[model samples]
Target: MPQNKAAIATQDAPAAIGPYSQAVRSGDLLFTSGQVGFDPASGALVSGGVEAEARQVLKNLAAVVGAAGLQMTDVVKTTVFLADMNDFAAVNAIYAEAFAGAEVMPARSTVQVARLPRDARVEIEAVARFA
Candidate 1:
């Protein structure tokens, strides 16, 4: 951790499974690490399907963003990663619903990846500005 940036953590979100912080705040921006569908309490990926996973992923991101004293509406950009491109529609719907309250929807990029940690259906990361 450098003096310019501080790592963010929250019990409301699942702990990082690797050598990374849940998020890091530097200057006016907060950058959240990618979050999957795992529940913080159970430490297990939520059941259902891509939609369920997408919802959980947003919840996890909200927790991380909130930990830094920001809200979903503050998010400026987001990157969504999916294990399968076929799940895009389902995840997109969930993603839209999660940030529906935002005055200006965050810019976004979604991509399909070969695999994800814990085999999650979807993962998301965000950049938010609180200052």
Candidate 2:
């Protein structure tokens, strides 16, 4: 977290609340920890519904990827965790907005979980390529 070659961190993103770095670089891939809707400034989950939360989640991911000197377009894959399957369409729409500039959209998976940290409606993690 101190600007090492392996661990990636940035003040633009919320600090990890657990024992993990925001993202870790392994060779040409950077594996990111799941990000929630918590605001980096207040460290509190954003208000509004799943749509808002999903947007914040993607924003957080962008921050992590940016810290790795990459952009959302560089994300090769993502695993989305949702508290409700019904929110898929909503989250997906927001997700698409973030990667609109990508020549090819990142591969993604969305699954409904029993619960999420901070009781967030949605959470997302990503893998980014250096190239």
Candidate 3:
């Protein structure tokens, strides 16, 4: 069995708010920690509603994936957490556009949660495979 390796974090994404790496790579697989709507520049939640927040979350995820020496196309799976299910359609639309050209359209699961760090509307994490 391969050992789990720590994935490097990037300045392109907001730094982890707690004691966690942005992502970890083991063998060919990379697992990202959940990212919220915080903007990297200010390290604060981007001022917006669910739609905008969701976009930021994806942007952050993209940054982490890139830091792992992989592109968004490498992603094979994702998990989305939303403060409310009412934003599902909007989030899905944005997510689709983001991964529109991804070589591997990842399988995904989204869940509605009572709350998230920073009280942000959306948080997203992904798993990618290095080819």
Candidate 4:
């Protein structure tokens, strides 16, 4: 049987710069593309350090998830890519605060990558489930 899939998009998040959807919904799950620290209105990475960029990344992810008719609390997993491992603590702090009130924090994996799109300090992607 063929699966039904739909692309999710929102003006609140920066548009994809390449040939990829912002997020794709397959059945009950929504898989979002990795979101860099680009500001939707400006189409540029947010100015500042890792912490600031991480904040914007989360906001972008939130916008994608929200467009799929889900909330941040619905996220079940996440993968974070960072340009530097040294920024882990700062990004972790921001990540924790971003999902503070959730009933259960999503499982996450964070790793240092050699580089990221637009030289962003951070990028984040999420998987959310809907009942």
Candidate 5:
């Protein structure tokens, strides 16, 4: 196995607001930090409600995953946090489509939270593996 390590950064996706990269690739595994609805280029929240923000979050995650040299299909696990359970069905609708119609889905857990950083309605983090 290769011992060299590297980080992935992409202009297509939102940049890390804090002290973190978009994604880190190590030994065939990629870990993406929790992504919110903020647009990295503009550094502002995507203009819309829950559905729109959720879509942006998913898109951002996709970009980070791609930066790690992987696709949504490569995602092995995910954890989704939402501000409200009422948005479950609505969020699921968009979340399902974000996976690009893949048949094999990753293990996932969704939960309602009291709040999140930046007051985002949703946030997502993922783990992927590459050969």
Candidate 6:
């Protein structure tokens, strides 16, 4: 049987560097690929520490969510990957502000990884539900 899925893309967000769509929608759920701090137009990692990277990451994820016709409040879960665990606090602070005012905050898992694509300090991916 064929899958009930559709690839989601938007120029507002960075293009995938590998074989993957920016996001995929199946049924009422939208799954976004990991987003780093890369600026969509220039394809360069934003210059700053984890805090700045985290902010851009959220913005990229939000762009994908919006492309799927969903809002940040619709995000049900997120997985955050950090190059350094020490930056957790900084990333967390920015993350909190990004999802502020949402009806319900999404569940999240954060972990430090050995490294990330393009040496990004942080990367984030999300799962959102559509009404």
Instruction: Count residue pairs with overlapping backbones in model 2.
Output: 0
Off by over 4 Å in 4: none
**Reference-based TM-score, model 4:** 0.97
Please give the RMSD of candidate 6 to the true structure.
0.7
Evaluated against the true structure, the overall lDDT of model 3 is 0.91
The candidate 6 region of ten consecutive residues with least summed lDDT is 47-56
- Please tell me which model should have the higher lDDT, number 1 or number 2: 1
Candidate 4 lDDT, tens digit per residue, 1-131? 88699999999999999999999999899999999999999998898889889999999999999998899999999999999999999999999988997999999998899999989989999999997
Q: Number of clashing residue pairs in every model?
A: 0, 0, 0, 0, 1, 0
Greater-lDDT candidate between 1 and 5:
1
| Candidate 5 positional error at 112, Å | 1.8
Candidate-wise lDDT, in order: 0.93, 0.92, 0.91, 0.94, 0.86, 0.94
Ranking by lDDT: 6, 4, 1, 2, 3, 5
Q: If both were scored by TM-score, which would come out higher, candidate 1 or candidate 4?
A: 4
Cα lDDT tens digits for candidate 1, 28-127:
9999999999999999999998888888999999999999999999999999999999988888888899999988999999999989998898899999
Please provide TM-scores, in order, for all candidate models, with all chains considered together: 0.96, 0.95, 0.94, 0.97, 0.89, 0.98
Per-residue lDDT tens digits for candidate 6, residues 1-131, read: 99999999999999999999999999989999999999999999999777778889999999999999998999999999999999999999999999997888999999999999999999999999988
Q: How close is candidate 1 to the true structure, as a TM-score?
A: 0.96
User: How far is 15's C-alpha from truth in model 1 (Å)?
Assistant: 0.4
- The Cα RMSD of model 2 versus the native structure comes to 2.9
Q: Looking at candidate 3, what is the lDDT of residue 90?
A: 95
Worst ten in a row by lDDT for model 2: 1-10
Measured over all alpha carbons after superposition, the RMSD of each candidate to the real structure, in angstroms, is: 1.5, 2.9, 1.5, 0.8, 2.1, 0.7
List the lowest-lDDT window of 10 residues for candidate 3. 1-10
Candidate 5 versus the native: TM-score? 0.89
Model 1's lDDT to the true fold?
0.93
lDDT of 2 by residue, 23-78 (tens): 99988999999999999999999999998898898899999999999999999999
